[model samples]
Target: MKKIPVMAAALSAALLSVVMLTTFSGCAKKPKLYLYNWTYYTPDSVLRQFEKENNCEIIYDTFASNEELYAKLLSGGTGYDLVFPSGDYVSIMIKQNMLEKIDKSKLSNLVNIDPMVLQKATYDPKMEYSVPYYFGAAGIAVNTARVPQYEKSWSIFGRSDLQGKMTMLDDMREVLGDALVHLGYSVNTANPAEIAAARDLVNSAWKPNLIKFDAEAFGKGFADEDFWVVQGYAEVVYEEISEEQKKNTAFFIPPEGGPAYIDSMCLLKGAKNVDLAYKFIDFIHRPEIYAEFTDYFGFPATANIPARQLKKVTPYYQAEELTNVELKDDMGENLTLYDDAWLTIRVGD
Candidate 1:
């Protein structure tokens, strides 16, 4: 057979290449819905199940604290679809117009959330901007094996005997709030004199015993026997300890009160997949589904009422201890006072 002319063959080849390119390009995957939240907030099994059921990819990222999460959202160009911010940050975000107002009707599983938690989310009082995820109080994690003499109290931080073996959270609010609690002042107090007095108490009482202020890995130090007592959230105690290590650990919320927080799932203004975001909120609220998260993380589920009935969850929330706990309020312009105070403490100035 005679070969086709060179020009004819070249034209055919170019057309074939175009067809192949179009076919492949049309099938290219789109960007996945992005979730920015606290480290270890979403369990591995929970994430895998959600992705499998939705038949969609989820891009997950983490920040260690609410302040970090807030700053990231404030920087803009985040393109995040969802974020888990505590109540106070939710309030701040709403004021800045960085969050998308949620359509309550879309949340079919809304009834699953405990009405009490919803009522307490003051940042979204109308329940129009966010949905409660998990709420817990900030407290102390004591390694009883290394230091058995301590009581279930915040006074552990002021114990001179534990000096160089104790750690307080690096979070300014938690440290300052504890100081406020110790001084018999409200954690949300904005009075200059009140804040000054609390600051002085922290500097004298907690500074000497504190080997370091660590929120990220104080648990590891506890496990390693480096820290005899450490300050952290109630959930952190459960998250970082192994079964063996747990035998020697005791978690406590001081008698006076501790800083309580409600972490809510908020929609970002840049969420490209609003419908799916709502679906996710509804999906995670199911009792059994929510139990998987609580059981794995070892904290009580606040928003999911049925989850509270689960054997694994019932033990975590002692209402008498946690019910009247103080939730951190959005300080707005008053945040500067906290920043300055934290800076001074960190520098020993």
Candidate 2:
């Protein structure tokens, strides 16, 4: 009977040891920062370093467009610590009270941002609620290997010979913005007539040649030679192609100009990891880190001034090329005008 009692005590001690180890392991798990950003925007190396230094895990999610981001937030998709939205949607979110005010006092690296980028961020010039990430524009990418002759202009979309071999972004603002600039109008115009004119141009001219309005797979389509010409972000198109193909690729913002955008990192309201979010934001602005980001994507350091000197790779397009490009502004209620016209274009010819 005494031996049985002794064995029971030993078993009890073993159980307690296992319980203690499990609890310790659970407590040792790292904290996580949830980030919602655009697809293809974040670099793995930069993220891994941040995670290692902070001893925290990063949970990143991606959205394809500003509308998708807005819709998700509007639908009560909470728990995200940070998000990346373009300048136009930044203004919209501010107006709707969907964001948290940034505490600049916590960001020592804030000084690294380029002043020119801040000036263009009229939506939040003070950066009270947002931090500018990258400023860029969509441009036409043509395969010089296939298309031997072409103009570096938006007008190329109208060439019947290139019909069914081209594709434009399905985004209303971007597509309309292209036509508006080509027609010598502002990209953010709320004028009913101007919006209609842009809509008509896309429907009557560009649409005839386009294989389809594509936003997601145009990069792959371009890479596979399924489409000879595509209008999209330089990074997106370049990401899908190899070095040899990139040599034959010509990416440029049209001379007549089109809409440009400044995508920003913002803290979402009710974020649980406020301190970690701020840390990540400041980390991103650090010269070396920002340079790493731009280099990974072959992007110009449009927002981080110091990072420009640190970048190792050549950008797909130069910053000066955006001189003629116009920033897209929040239309507020006037957006309905463009929406109505876009409806006709999408549903019609």
**lDDT of each candidate versus the true structure:** 0.80, 0.91
Residue pairs whose backbone atoms clash in candidate 2? none
lDDT, candidate 1, 82-158, per-residue tens? 89998998888888888899898898787888877766676676768888888778677787787878776677788
Judged by lDDT against the true structure, how good is candidate 2? 0.91
Name the best candidate (by TM-score). Answer: 2
lDDT value, candidate 1, whole model = 0.80
Q: Count the backbone clashes (under 3 Å) in each candidate.
A: 0, 0
TM-score of 2: 0.90
Tens digits of per-residue lDDT, candidate 2, 159-272, equal 999888999998889999999999999999988889889999999999999999998999999999999999998988998999899989999999888999999999999999
Please give the lDDT score at residue 202 for candidate 1: 84
Distance from true position, residue 299, model 2, in Å?
Answer: 1.3
Error of 1 at 133 (Å): 0.9
